[model samples]
Target chain A: MIELNDYLILSGLLFTIGLVGVLRRKNLLMLFFATEVMLNAANIAFAATSHYYNDLSGQMFAFFIIAVAASEVAVGLGLLIVLYKRHGTLDLDNLASMKG
Target chain B: MYEQIAFYLFSVLIIGLFLVTVLTKNVLYSMTSLAAGMVLIAGIFFTLGADFLGVVQLIVYVGAIMALYAFAMMFFDVTKDVKENNTNGSLIFLLGGLTALMFVIIMSAPIMSENIQALYPPMAGVTNPQAVGMVLFTKYLVPFEVAAVMLLVAMIAGIILAGKKMDQSLTTEDDVIVEIDILEEDEK
Candidate 1:
């Protein structure tokens, strides 16, 4: 039997990978991808718990997370385009102009 | 038995693909692998009996979001390698490991305390999507409407930000400024 713990472990692993990517990757788009991975990890945990406990609330949360993610991409990608236009590079270090 | 096999297979594949998405330097490879990983996640959702969520994962993440990313990638020099300045490598690994361990411990707490009950259990004879629709319409209606409004706002903002007017920099090279310069020269 595939227990809830298995899904949770997998989710944790995925989330950790995402955190590392966020820490290490310099590209703005890649950073966004890493955040997507983290969000997906949370979704897995939520859906799994919802399944095991026979509840819909966890899935509801997952649904909201997806909607938020979509909104994030729309806004974030627009910002990225503007940034790329102003500055020719997508490197995070170069984009860190507000670091005073 | 089959479900277990499917779950394990999907887990391994999803993890590997996501690793490629995160670790790869090539933007095209990262984007493609991310899309594949998302589709595999939808498979996992199906095995977990979240039919609606599985479909949404397929459509929104794989279909819409990934496509948007790929389109955005075309705006930049995709062939150029992304340069990263990771100052402390060992620290990242140490912190990531500790975080993963802490998450594992926290997640296990739920399994240890099995008495936590479901708030809205799935009613018998109700399909997953049907049940979701019922709850969403009645209980989650306000939030759903809010999400719609948020998405609308995001769309408008994205259009405005990435619009054609971006070509004319107000501080430097604006067409209107050039026209004004031409008019001042004529007046002089």
Candidate 2:
């Protein structure tokens, strides 16, 4: 039988990988992808726990999370398009126009 | 035995695809990998008996969001090769590892100490989708309505932002004159 710890551990590892990607990647799009990975990691944790505890609230949270993620990507990609138009590049190094 | 094997397989596939999505320099490849990873996550949901969530994940993430990503990718002249210059790589790894270790320790602490009993054991005959729907509409009615509104607002915002003229330098007077000229030309 698969234990709850096993699922939690998997989630932790996935979240770690996403954090590394977020820290190391320079492209905004890649950052968003990493963020999605992290969100999925959380969703897995929630679902696993909900299953272990025999609760439906966790799945509901995951459902809402998916909805929020969809809206976020829509707005974020729109912003990315506008940013690329203004800056001509998506490289983080060149997008430091607001540097203090 | 089969459940354990399937769990491991889905986990491995998801992690590998996510790594490709994050580490690859090619944006299109990354998007493809992301979509694959999401589908694999839905597989994991199915293994865990969250059938409704698994199908919803397939529809929302792998279907709708990824389609939008593919459409957006076409608008940008993304470079085929992207060079990454990570200066503080070691420092970042050190901090990230420490944080992850902390998170794992904190999260697992409760499970390690306490014997948590499941309040609602998985009902073999109960339909997962119907149960989820019952709670969603009854207990979460307000939040559901709010989510619908939020999606609507996001749709409007995305269209407005992406459809705006790229040349922001054009004055309002110039824009009005150009619109007027186009209207007059249309009438002629």
Tens digits of per-residue lDDT for model 2, B1-188: 99899999998888899889877888888888999999999998998889999999999999999999888887787657777888998898888778988988887787788776654444467799988887889888999999999999999999988889755655887999999999999999
Best by TM-score: 1
TM-score (0 to 1) of chain B for each candidate: 0.82, 0.78
**Candidate 2's chain A scores what TM-score?**
0.96
- Candidate 1 structure quality by residue, lDDT tens digits, B38-140: 9999999999999999999999999999988988888798897777777998898789878878887886686687777888888899999999998888889
Q: Chain A TM-score per candidate?
A: 0.96, 0.96
Q: Against the true structure, candidate 1 has what lDDT? A: 0.91
TM-score of each: 0.89, 0.87
Deviation (Å) of B158 in candidate 2: 0.7
Clashing pairs in 1: none
lDDT of each: 0.91, 0.88
DockQ of each: 0.75, 0.65
| Model 2 CAPRI quality | medium
